[model samples]
Target: MRRNQRQAALVCVTNQYSCERLILAGKNLALSEGLELKVLCVQPPEYASGSYLAEIEYLFAVSRRAGAEMIVYYRDDPVRAAVTFIHANRIAHIVLGGVPDPAGSAF
Candidate 1:
């Protein structure tokens, strides 16, 4: 990130298909506002055994195509990490996906 450019971020903390829309939206917003797009994905501890490695790779590819610089953080709380990253990057805006119901099995 340069001093003259603004930055927007997309937080995709889960291994779900819905992140595509976030990436797309972030890309569009960044382009429209002349901001750099940054993407973050945090892998939870349960998936540290490489169960979802392939899906992570797919996400990396998708984010790259969307012109976002993607970063994958391992073994951390997704929400907290997202906030930390956003603050560190001095991001002006953030794009995120819809959260599933807390009572349901997903996260």
Candidate 2:
């Protein structure tokens, strides 16, 4: 990456609580020098009512204004989607809001 190139980070928010946490985390990441924050709101297959998309977009804009580029990914299973996105985009970091038990939790 060039000096002007920004490092990208994705934050996966799977729930209301997670979304709030992810926003705060994204803001912090945005403040870092040359880092871009992407807030991805993961909606389940049935619960995707399109209400959170705008919120996600708004957060992305805020991140951009904070000196980092902002983007939003609204999809089923935001975590998995974000992982795929990062791999495709060669993102450097993934900032998860909380610790999840892989064995107990199904993604």
Candidate 3:
């Protein structure tokens, strides 16, 4: 990718905690590619009752230290929200956690 492009490396987290690794990965990838780092979390509206506020704040701090901004989107369809965010932010790289399903389960 060109250095002058407005591209970003996005780290997608599923919850408010356990995101340090993702953030670090995004930071390293962004630094190597000359891109900006971004952190994203998508959750259902019901989970927005502030129950995980502290954890979210902590993740925000981690992201800040990693030179990335953490953004949270409350939506029923996480895939759609993430897609929109990617398009809006001109994301060039994405880092996320997942495990293979031997049975090919579908969400």
Candidate 4:
């Protein structure tokens, strides 16, 4: 990011579906304001069912349509990766999904 440029929003979407939702919201925000969106996705094990790649492609499409940049990462430490992205991109704000509590299924 340049010094005279406006900061972009860093969105941490948990899954492919959530990424779509976040992209929509981010686009709306960007449209209302003079800012861009930086969509970021983080997943455990980095790859699962090839969904990560699909999500990245989806994000890219959304970003291209919205005139924004997409940054997706599949890693073990999602939060850390997101933080790194935020710092690297000089993101102004962070939009994140809720984290579910750790629990087991009933017998």
Return the top candidate by lDDT: 3
TM-score of each: 0.77, 0.54, 0.84, 0.70
Question: What local lDDT score does residue 41 receive in model 3, on the 0 to 100 scale?
Answer: 92
lDDT of 4 by residue, 67-101 (tens): 77765566788779877777666677776655445
What does candidate 3's lDDT look like per residue over 13-74, in tens digits?
86646778889988999999999899999989998998778888888889999999889988
Ranking by TM-score: 3, 1, 4, 2
Supply candidate 4's per-residue lDDT for 35: 74
Per-residue alpha-carbon lDDT of model 2 for 22-71, expressed as tens digits? 65676676566345666555556555566666665565555555444444
Tell me the spans in candidate 3 whose CA falls farther than 4 Å from its real position: 1-5, 100-107
Worst 10 residues of 3 by lDDT: 1-10
> Model 1, clash count?
0
Consecutive 10-residue window with the lowest summed lDDT within model 4: 98-107
The lDDT of each candidate is: 0.76, 0.59, 0.87, 0.69
lDDT of 1 by residue, 3-88 (tens): 56565655454676667777888888888888778888888787878888887778788888988789887756777977777767
Runs in model 4 lying further than 4 Å from the true structure = 1-5, 46-52, 99-107
| RMSD to true structure for each model, in Å | 4.5, 6.0, 4.9, 5.6
Worst 10 residues of 2 by lDDT: 65-74
Give model 1's TM-score versus the native structure.
Answer: 0.77
